[model samples]
Target: MCPVTVFEQDGCDLRVEWGLDGVHALGPHCAVLVVVDVLVFTTTVDVALGRGARVLPLPWRDERAAAMAEALGAVLTPPGLDESYGQPGWTLRPSSLTDLPAGTLLGIASPNGATLAAAAAETGTAVLAGCLRNASAVAAAASAIAEDRPVGVIAAGERWRPERTLRPSIEDYLGAGAIAAAVTGRSAPSSEATLAAVSYRAVRDRIPALLGGSISGRELIAAGVPEDVALATDVDVSTVVPVLDNGVFTS
Candidate 1:
């Protein structure tokens, strides 16, 4: 008989010893769960696709984003990089948030998304990347691979340097809840997640305020793209899931 184990935090089992260490420790047979909470990586993919701009992912900052874009005859812009982070090579573009050039590579730094993307680079399959903006689409893509297994949902938290009392944002949980409801056919595990999506469902106006507390939400606001987050939280906005292909973002 197979033994039973339980992880008390969410009433979940140990689930194969989570964390990047555990995932890499396994070496093989690790199903990757990518949760992109920054809202920039996933949302930009969705928005660009929606507006007919092709997108890619640059795992590092070494001219790759620009090099790939130039090779594809497109313009590149860095959304997550900041002056404090010592950005390189035209990291900020005035036209990025609105006018994304086709074949653009979005360089992201969310620890959660990066971790899952790395894991997906290993397995090639069973690596699901998702956000609340594309939650339903991600759920559908994941369901195709899930095929009777509990898929991982890595929550990409803040994009800043690690702090002592760091906390996960409501947006991540809200996105997780949406993905869970779509994939698990269950309600949100907490009021925050439930209200996040449900509130958007009930009133289309609260999304901006709800997202104002998110990691990217504040940055976006500071960058003068607050409306982007509001636009991102719109549920079922796209048909693309934006999976990680050998470290790049692809549908």
Candidate 2:
């Protein structure tokens, strides 16, 4: 009834939505989007820039991704970090809002969420990453940006799979609510965002259980990353905004 449209597609509905094929066909067309890969998105961005690497985002066949980065003076790297670190060329890195301050521009190379960020960046609007960790801060920043300019929020999900069914990232969705709360100044989020927020909030005590259920969580524990998830789950530490520039991710 709000006249706003929300698109939902997955698994059994993949065929109806055209699944992976649909993303390639429809993803590029979005004017603005904020791909919120929350857990890894902001964390990876923070780590890459904190390490002092120039990050450039390359999205498979999306020519515009590289073109935009190049246009902004960013260097191109191998498809993924594996190939990039094996060679040389500024050593492309990853970044997010938590790594830089407001007003700094960055060219991102997200292995998984490049298309969403690319679409948003294409619109001449300020593109900022959002996460539950920085949800309120990001929303405030986005609201300020939107007051005088257009802004879009994109939730970066796992890899696009046509035939395979994937569940939406609960963390990212909760982060989105935080963003919406900041943007709209409403006591509650839109129905969809509210559900996401409630879901994640409800699982507060079950983080360990939830982690055990996740592929990445199991991998991290198995690899003995030592507090990797705990570090990622830190609710508040610094309110830095990571920005990408010339293939470098800086705060």
Candidate number of the best lDDT: 1
TM-score of each: 0.65, 0.60
- Cα RMSD (Å) per model? 6.0, 7.4
Structural RMSD, model 1:
6.0
Model 2 Cα lDDT, one tens digit per residue, 143-183:
55445332345555554345434445545554454455446
lDDT of 1 by residue, 10-37 (tens): 3221122223443343223323354555
- Per-candidate clash tally: 0, 21
Please give the range of 10 consecutive residues that has the lowest summed lDDT in model 2: 9-18
